[model samples]
Target: MTTPPSPPNPKAIIFDLLTGLLDSWTLWDASTPTGTSLEGRKWRKQYLEVTFGSTVYGPGSTYEELVARSAGESGLPNSAPEALLQNWKDLTAWPEVGRVLRALREKGYLLGVVTNCSKKLGHAAVRNAEKAAEGAGEGTWKFDAAVTAEETGWYKPAVQAYHGILPLLGEGVRPEDVLFVAGSAGDVVGATKAGFRVVWNNHVGLERKGDVLPLREGKSLDEALRDFL
Candidate 1:
């Protein structure tokens, strides 16, 4: 078993939107029929990996379409999937997330968020983290940059998406200098392919398959780094 890597004194930390920062699974867990606790959210993640790229529809679709389809596929039809999309704005950082971010900021690491949402929704999600962080007395969640597929017209795990985000991370930040925080297997592989070091935010005990290695992994961002200290 390859252990997670220690941070190479990262210049910035770029977080994945859906699973990295917010708790999107709870929403799925609330529904998911047949057998009562089959974990429909896992299906949703796999669905995203498929739909975010070339599938039946070709290339990809918007966040709205993705959510609606995932909901419908997971037995949440007539569940107002679009309403769930808006619910992102109401999400707070997962437990200890704000504290971990504050610690990184104290060390002068710039922070960012990368998502496959529109310009409008992506920024709103950032505000969601900002609210949660500050309310936790961890200071405001300030990001040095934010990127969305809607803004760049490319979903993640694709070189184009990472390229779109790299330049926005700030003046001197290099692809090698930024630490990409991955919430899923696709994220880990994608960011690695993009030549960025990575940290796996494995909050849900998701398996780490394939050859892509991460800098670290932990239930919470804080606990992950403890190995290095």
Candidate 2:
């Protein structure tokens, strides 16, 4: 048996589609009224300060620490910290994500979504993606595969989470043949570690932390795909 030649075009463009928790998650909106514009980043900054006591500062912090900090401040018992995690369904897609994803799919590339969301929310995000695609003038944006944290038992920055997608691919896909797009530095590090070409979706123009090294950076998914092409 011989391995197939790597696809001249990528076999898949794997996306770490963060759940609408920042934009749509009702719990977050209720907790803070800053609106989704920069509200998510603001909450996360406060969350880090409140939870980490000045130690860890960003989303790049270890998931265990994040959960621990959030649970502590959330007034939830550490024994069952699940409830402290933010609800994701309240998030709405960014204005252009739907249209861009649909267009990418129409261009004949395989599309996959990987997220650190619970299964229920993950499914909702996919539906949101499909709807967004439709609004963008594409009828539907169906993914070839979708992996949620509930299925992977890990989160971004964990090599296991990235590796979890490998076996889900169809016959010819290789890790190197997939391009991952993520908005967070930790996610970029994890994806790069897992051997995927990574594109940082730096929509806000945040500076990269020292540890993360992405293959490319773009201000939007459209720009990211353009560079990929």
Candidate 3:
């Protein structure tokens, strides 16, 4: 069956939904052995082990499930603890990213942040984005809505994550009206499947294969927006 065309001007907003879309490599890079890349995942596993004290595996055994189990186990006061927030807040924007987003926002588009990061990390990233936007002389970029995986109870590649945010948008918005920006192929696929206008921010020059071609592609946030707008 043929797919319908996307709406030209959506009542809804644009979403930069994840660490990749908000923060640059510094926040997500796991090259440092103790960083989230290597240690973050392990930390989550161990945290869950200590908290749950049992091998609690959910469907797909995905990172999102593990994080949920850990949060349930930690019983930590905040949705995201200080340690995680400190680690995540250190992220910065890629070259011209702030400028591009500001340009889009000035065009009267509502900007939102939907991320798979735990609530703490997601909020931290948003704070960083606000700082970057300020530095760019754009004033603080306030998100129309910021939805984290913790709140949604699902992760990217799962339809629920996208569906969960639909109600938060303005009335009369449909999936196609949203521009879902993602750097990872999996995110691109997931957003596309959810009926969004997928914008792949391929910063690292990763190989693209089947299905990757159908969506919009950009090497940086600036490049993506240039084509998108």
Candidate 4:
């Protein structure tokens, strides 16, 4: 006897907007290193590790301000932090990202963008994406809803953030029925524990850790999402 076909998609897919969908690492990499010494590089890396989440979700803190703080703490050149902020404000989505997002929308997925950023920057990222697509003639892109941690008062890797905001996005949607896309290990772990199936968007071949694997992992956004597509 033949088996019945499965449904075409989940109830929705939530994106970890910045690093996950926007490829922040690529841009981060192009910046001049803060220092040449091994200790200095290590220190800068540590600063990034903290700044990525804390600055966004911290009460009254924005990415730009916290990044400058990180630069100072990391002992970087004076000009570095503002340059980083400008790069951030000018962020654009990756080539083909808009097309994929459009495809997902057409496929009937209720899309969401969750980011640890100020409300202004979170929305700015979406608008930036729209501009990027238009400038590249890639086509328009939009999401059904967006959540910023600054508004919610929580950050990723914390279960409260996911469990709290999801209901607001799609009432009655179960975590098991939600798909989350993320690039960082903290994000992967948080999403898994929150009960959403995760796409570990490991676009740079970062070594996977522990045994609790993502529902999928890949070197490109398209590859990480192939299963759903």
Maximum-lDDT candidate: 1
**TM-score against truth, every candidate:** 0.84, 0.72, 0.70, 0.79
What does candidate 4's lDDT look like per residue over 20-39, in tens digits? 77765544544436323343
- Give the alpha carbon lDDT tens digit for every residue of 35-139 in model 3: 444544434434424322222223544444454445445443234334444455556767666676677777877677766556765677777776667777844
Candidate models: Cα lDDT each: 0.69, 0.60, 0.58, 0.67
TM-score of 3: 0.70
Write out the backbone clash pairs for model 3.
17-114
Tell me the TM-score of model 2.
0.72
Model 4, C-alpha of 117: deviation from truth (Å): 1.4
| Model 2 score (lDDT) | 0.60
Error of 3 at 48 (Å): 18
What's model 4's overall lDDT? 0.67
Q: Over the full model, what C-alpha lDDT does candidate 3 score relative to the true structure?
A: 0.58
Locate the minimum summed-lDDT window of 10 residues in model 3. Answer: 48-57
User: In candidate 2, what are the lDDT values of residues 66-134, reduced to their tens digit?
Assistant: 645554564434442343245444456667787677667777778888776556767777776767777
Model 3 residue 16 distance off true place after TM-score fit, in angstroms: 4.0
Worst 10 residues of 2 by lDDT: 48-57
